[model samples]
Target: MSGASNSGAALGSLLRQIIVWVVFAAVVVVLPHLFTSGSSISMMSQMGVFILFALSYNMLLGEAGMLSFGHAVYFGIGGFFTLHAIRAVNDGVFSWPLELMPLVGGAGGLLFGIIFGSVSTRRAGVTFAMITLGIGSLVESSANMFTDFFGGESGISANRVTEVTLLPFSYGPQIQVYYLIGAWTVFAALLMYLLTRTPLGRISNAVRDNPERAQFVGYNTTMARFVQFALSGFFAGIAGGLFAIMFEIMTASNVGLIQSGSVLLMTFIGGVGVFFGPIIGAVLITYMQTALSGFSEGWILYFGLLFVFMVMYAPMGIAGVIVAHFAPWRAGQLHRLIPVYALAVVPAMLALAGLVSVIEMGYHLSLAYDPSQPIDLFYMQVNVTRLLPWVVAVVVLAVGVALLKWVSGRIRERWNDINKTTERPEAAR
Candidate 1:
């Protein structure tokens, strides 16, 4: 009876997992239909690419406890190689399906990961991070030196629509490209998720938590880390390949510090503690990058402020905060915190509005200052040359901050109440 019940439970778990994946695929398929625009399709494709890249980074930082500042090395290398492959196909030098080109990029990344991981994985922690950074710098510098391959500053370009596809349709359409990226994104996500259930994945986690103990238990911690790093490179390379296909270009910047930093920001802001954290992070950050940059020159400033806020106040990230309420939800105590959250949001929005006003005025003064021109603030023309608007904005910001501080205390108290109530049942059991 016990064995049968265990088997039944396992079957149910598998069924639930299948349903979740199906739903995820459904959402990916349905999204393009809802947002039927060329730019939206393009933006979603970029999101899909970053989602894979961020998830791969999470495999190192979150699961294997290896923080990488140079992960983009693999991404750029893979992209360049993939573009070269596409060029080869376009030139009649080879006949291959473009759909499988990302695999070639994966192979390139895996090869380099093996080459680099052997040395970098020798030491853990800051040493490993610094080594990766150095390696990235070396590769980036080599890009200019190897002009034939790297194309110097112009970079490499290729045509993805080489009439080499498994389907009858040419992948020239943005929607088609979106589907290709979506397919790979789902495929890579599943493989990464499955990796977490494998022996290497478990050993990687062990090495992450306590390298000494992992070594004591007859596991080569360095080897496990190397494997994890290489696999991460493989996935990152896949993202790079998709990037090549989508943009038809691979440049030095793709493998530079900025690209590496962008992925790091995505993974960290998404909450490296959870599997789906990077997904949320990638989607949100990508939207901000694509949308917010169009509206203001200070979007980078706003982005930085957001990162700082997440690191300081919500270290667990957006997903982590959402996950934290699950216990209370299960125990029927979540409603207690809803009103408090609603109360807090009002002051938060007001504070954000005031902050935006100040930032916009500052940008107007420094970037495109003109006494005759008025900057738009909250849908109204505001003269930065005047003092009253500044004073009003400052006052609003001050008031909002003060109110938010007071409300936060109440929020804390309510959370304490909910946590206690939920824990009592577990304690009694």
Candidate 2:
């Protein structure tokens, strides 16, 4: 009877998972209909690439506890190779589906990962990071030297429209490319997630948490790290292939320091401890790049400030913050945080306004044609050139900072009180 009940529960759990995946697939399929524009489709395609890229990165940083400063090398390698493959297909060298191109990139990434991981996995932590950085620098320099493959500064470009596929359709339209990306994104994400359930994945975590213990327990720690690194590279390469397919171009910058840093920022800002964290971070950052950069030249400044703010106030990243609140919400004490959070908003907004104003004023005086032009503040124009405005902005910033510190202390105290009140008596005793 107990065995039957256990089997039933397991079957129910599997059904739930299937339902959830079906819903997610439906949402992905429906999104393009809602945002039916070439630009929007392109943006979503990029988001799909980034989602895989960031998640694969989490396999290293989150699962294996490996910090790679040059992960983009794998991505670029895969992209360059995939571009060549696409061109070959266009030239009628062979026929292959555009959807299968990412697999080629994955193969390239896996090969390089084995070569690089062999030497680097010997040392962990900072040493591994430095070695990876050196390798990245070497690859970037080589891209120019090997212009035949990398296509020099101009890079390589191909027409996905000419490639023969299993289907009668050419991947000419952005919507076609978007669906290709979406399908691959789902596949890569599912594969990576399943990898976490395997013995190798579990042991990788064990090695991450305590390599010495993992070794003592009869596991080869170095081998585990190497395998994990190789797998991460493969997935990253897959993402790179998706990138190439979407953009139909591969460049030196694809594997450069900026690309490496972007993924690192996304992974870190997404909460490295959580599996789904990078997905959220990837989407948020990609959207910001698409939408925010268009708003002003100072968009990078705003992005940098937001990153710093998250690092300072919420070190766990956005997903972590959301997860933190789940306990209170489940306990019905979420309402208590409403007023506390509202109080925090005033200081946060004031500080943001003042800092943005200062940045704008400096940019205006140094770069803009007219320094006396009124800068928009909350939709209201303020003459930033005036001494009074400068003084007021600085004062507001200072006051906001001071008040924020005080209010934070009060909230912390209240938070502790609430936790104490909500504690289970049996455990407390």
Candidate 3:
């Protein structure tokens, strides 16, 4: 009876997981159909690109426990190769479809990863990170200095209307591009997940947890790291290729330190220890970049602060926090807390908006602009506003944050008490 009950519970859990994934996949496919706006489609496509990039990044930090500061080399190389593929397809050098060009990017990344991994994998920890950083800087400087291969600072551009699309659909349609991105994202994600379940993946984890122990157990740690790093590069390259296909161009910025840091932030914030954490981080960060960056010159500063908070308070990340609440939420025990959460959201939104407005105004004020074209604060457009709104915004934000903190503390205390009372004594035993 016990075994049967355990089997049934396991089956139910698997079914629930499958259902969740199915629902998510359905939403991804259906949401774009509901939006006829080009900008929305574009944003979704960019999200897909970032998702791939973040997941690839996680393969290293999450699975291998290797912190890389120069993973952008693989991404940039893949982008460069993708641009060439685009040019070739446009110039009739290859008959392959536009969708197939990303494979070239993946291949390029794999090669670069193998080469770099050979050297970097010789050491671990800070030494490894520093080596990767040096490699990244070298590549970025080369991209800028060498005008021929990199196309100089202007980077490279390709015609999107190439004859390489397998489907009889025109590449000019935003919907087509959206579908291409969606399909690729799913493929890459599935492949990466499968890789995580392989023997190599298991060994990588063993190596991460204890490299010396793994070596003593007869596994080559260096080889494992090299293979892991190379595979990570392959996926990162695919992400770069996706970027090129979606935007029809590649620039130094695509593979620069900023790009590398963004991927790191996404992976770290998503939860480097969990497989799906980076995906969550990628989506959240992409949304913030699109929605919040335009609102503030201090956006980077805010992001830095947020990262610090995550490291200090929620080291496991947003996904980890959600998971921590799963038991109570899943059992419907926390349903009564909805009203409190909703109440907190209003002042929070208002405070955030006002803060963003002040930052946006300050950003414009720093830029030398003509007084003839006035900026509008109400419209949230670029404005040359004085300090009055800024002062008012600061005051409101402080009060709202204080209220939020107080409310959160109360909620957490109640939650802990409920959990303590409701938890089974036998379960604890």
Candidate 4:
């Protein structure tokens, strides 16, 4: 009877996961058609790029337990190749379809991965991270110095309105690009997830947990690291290619330390232990950047603070926090918490938007104009007002945030109580 019950529970869990995934896929597929707005589509496409980048980073940090500081080198090189491929396709030197441009990035990543992995895989832990950091810095400095290839600070741009699109759609249309990106995002995510189930994937975990134990069990730890690193690079390259295609531009910024660090933040904030955690992190971080960076000069500082807090308080990430509540969400307790979660969304969004606006206004003042430019707080456009509205906004934001925190705390307590009750019997057993 116990065996039968366990099998039934496992089947139910699998069905729930499958259903959730299918719903998410359907939403992604239908979103472009529903929105039809250029800006919306473009933002969605950018999200897809970040999703790929974050997932690739997770392959190393999550699966292989390798902390890479130079992952951007592979991604940047991939972008460069993607741009070149676009140029070649446009100039008739190559006869590939526009949809296939990402392959160029993938191949570039694979080539560089093999070269770097061969050396870096010899060392693990802090040594490996330092080596990658050094390599990344070297590549970035070379990019700046070699103006001939990298186009200096101006970067390189490619025309996407080419004659090579596989479908009847034009690349100029944002909706069409969104669909393409959405498709690619799903495909790449599926591939990466499948990879975690392979023999190499299993060995990667072994190497991550204890290299010495893996060696004792007759595994070549170096070989395992090398393969995993190379694979991670390949995925990062694909992400870079997606970025190039979406933006139609590639710059040193794409492959610099900042870019690599951002990917790390996304993965770590998402939940390194959970497969879908990084994806959630990518989407949240990307959205925050897009929404907040425009309003505040201090956005980076705020982001840094948030990251530090997460590292200290919620090391498992936002997903981990959510999962903690449901414990075994597959058991169906998650459904009960939906109302409480939904209740927190509105106040949270309002508070966040207010904070972002204040930040953006401050940023605009610093970057664009001095004290001469009139600060605009409410509407966000340039105005002749002084600091009165800004002061009001700050107070409002503070109060709103405090309220949000209070409400969230209550919800969390309730969730914990329910979860504790559910787990008591299992613990006693």
Candidate 5:
């Protein structure tokens, strides 16, 4: 009876997990129906691609505690080769489905991973990071130098619709491509999640937490790191393949320093400690990139500031902040935080407004196509060249900072009081 009960419980848990995944997949598939815009579909497709990229990166950061500066090397290599594969199949070299091209990209990444991880995994921490960075720099430079393969500064482009398909998918439509990306993304995410439950994954975590202890326990720390790095590269390559297909282009920039930094930002800002943290980070960052780029030339500045704020205050990323509240919520003590949170919001908004105003004004004066163009903020038009606007922005910033400092203290006190009260019973028990 006990064994049967345990089996049933396990089945029930499995069923619940399947249901969650099914609902998520359904939402992804139906999103285009709701949004119904060409740009939205394209944006979401990029989100799906980055989702895989970020999650693969988290395998290093969250799972293995290895910080990589050159992870984009795998992604870029995968993408560049995948573009070649597309060209090859198009020229009647071989018949292959577009659906399986990502595998080729994965192979590209695996090949590079084996090559690079062999050298880099011997050293841990900053030594490993520097080695990876150097390797990345070398590869990126080679992309330009080896123009026969990389196709020079313009990059390589291919038509994705060249592959023969049974499902009437030309893959020329953004929505059709999005479905492919969405399906592959979910499949990849499931695989990565399952990897976390494997013995290798468990040992990877062990190595991450305490490499010395793991080594003492007779596990080869360097080998463990190599395996994880290789796996991460594989998934990242898959993401690169998707990027190649989506844009129908591959460039040195795809595997360059800028992209390496972007993925790092995504992983760190999403909550690098959790399994789904990178997914959140990817979605948030992708949305920001797509949505914010059109409005301001200084979107990068705003994005960087937001990331800095998250790093300083949230630390665990957006997902971590949400998860942190779960204990209080489950204990029915969440109501206690409502007033404190409300008090914090005013200063937060003011701070944001003041900061945005200053940034916009600076951009307008320094880089706007016409420096004479007035800036708009919260329905107010401000002349950036005017002294009055500068004074207003400075004053607002000073006041907002002062108010935030005061409110944050009170908020912290309340937070501590609630946690202490809630945990008192557990301590007594």
Candidate 6:
């Protein structure tokens, strides 16, 4: 009876996993139909590419506990190689489908990852990070020196709509590109998740948590780290291939320190503790990069502020915060916390609104080409010269901060009580 019960439970878990993947696949397929815009498609394609890149980074940062400041080395190299392959295909030097060109990028990324990882993985902590940074700088410098391959400042471009495609559709439209990216995103995400269940994945985690113990247990810690790094580069390279196909251009900036830093920001902001955290971070950050930049000059400042806030307040990340509530939810105590959460949200919004006003005003004063020109802000023409708007914004910000402090105490007390109640049954068990 015990064995049968275990089998039944395993079967149920497998069924639930199948359902989740199917729903996710369906949503990816249906999203373009609902949005039906060129920009939206383009944005989604970017999101898919970053989602894969961020996940690849997490395989190092989150899973293997290796911090990389230069993962973009693999991503950019993969892209550059893919572009060259695309040119070769276009020239009839080789026959290959556009659908499989990302594999070329993956191959390129893997090759470099193996070369770089061999040296970088020798040391585990800060030393590894520094080595990667140095390597990234070296590659960025080489891009200019080797203008033939790197294309100097002009970069390289290729037309994706050649006769080499396995799919029915020509890979010309943004919509087709979006679908291709989405498919790869799903495929890669599944593989990464599966890796977490494998022996190498477990050993990687062990190496991450305690390298000394991992070494003592007969695992060559360096080899484990090297393999993990190379595998991560493989996926990152796949993302680069998708990036190349989507953009049809590769630049020196793509492989630079700035690009590497951007991926780090995305992974850290998303919540490295959880598997899905980077996905949330990538999607949100990508949206902000694309959508918010059009509206405000200080969007980068806002983005930085957001990262600071997340690091200080919710270190677990957006997904981590959501996951935290599951215990209360399962215990039927979630309803008790809802009202407290609602109360806190009001003051938080007020604080955000005020902060946004101040930021916009500051940008207008400091960065605007013409300070005399009235700026359209939040659907109202606000003169920077006028003092009333400043006064209003300050007052609102101060009041919101004050109210938030008061509400936060109540929220903490309520959550503490709920946690105690929820834990009682588990304690008994």
Clashing pairs in 4: 295-359, 295-360, 296-359, 296-360, 297-363
Residues 1-429, candidate 2: write the lDDT tens digits.
Answer: 999999999999989877877786787799999999888888989989999999989999999999999999999999988999989988889887886889999998999999998999999999999999999999998999999999999999987776467677688888888888898888789888889989999999998899999999899999999999999999999999989988889999999988998998888888888788898889989998989787667777877887898899888888898898887787788889888889989997887778777777777667878878887766878886789878977988888888889889978987897787678753677
lDDT of 2: 0.88
Over 1-429, each residue of candidate 1 has an lDDT whose tens digit, in order, gives 999999999999999989988998999999999999999999999999999999999999999999999999999888998999999998999988999999988988899999999999999999999999999899898999999889999999998999788988689999999999999999999999999989998998898899999999899998899999999999999999999999999999999988999999898899988889999999999999999999999998988999999999998888899899899888998889889999999899889988998898888877784754897788899988789988989988988999999999999999999888888888999
Candidate order by decreasing TM-score: 1, 6, 5, 2, 3, 4
Candidate 4 wrong stretches, greater than 4 Å:
1-17, 328-420
Candidate 4, residues 53-124: lDDT per residue as tens digits?
Answer: 889989899999999999998888888888888988889997888787788898999899999989988999
Q: Estimate, for each residue in 1-429, the C-alpha lDDT of model 5 and write its tens digit.
A: 999999999999999989988987998988999999898899999999999999999999889989999999999999988999999999999887898899999999999999999999999999988998998899999998999778999999999997576577899989999999999899999999999999999999999999999999899999999999999999999999999999999999998988999999999999987888999999999999887898778999877988889988998988898899998898788998899889878887888788888888898899877877787877987878889988988888888899999988988898898899889989999
lDDT of 6 by residue, 202-241 (tens): 9999999999999997999999899999999999999999
**Which 10 residues in a row give candidate 2 its minimum summed lDDT?**
160-169
- TM-score of each predicted structure versus truth: 0.98, 0.93, 0.87, 0.82, 0.96, 0.97
Question: For candidate 5, what is the lDDT?
Answer: 0.91
Q: What C-alpha lDDT, on a 0 to 100 scale, does residue 13 get in candidate 4? A: 87
lDDT ranking, best first: 1, 6, 5, 2, 4, 3
How far out, in Å, is residue 338 in model 3?
A: 3.9
**lDDT of all predictions, in order shown?**
0.92, 0.88, 0.83, 0.84, 0.91, 0.92
* Runs of candidate 1 exceeding 4 Å displacement: 1-5
At residue 48, give the lDDT of candidate 3: 88
Q: Over 4 Å off in model 2, which ranges?
A: 1-19, 426-429
**How close to the true structure is residue 40 of candidate 1, measured as C-alpha lDDT?**
95
Model 6, C-alpha of 305: deviation from truth (Å): 0.8
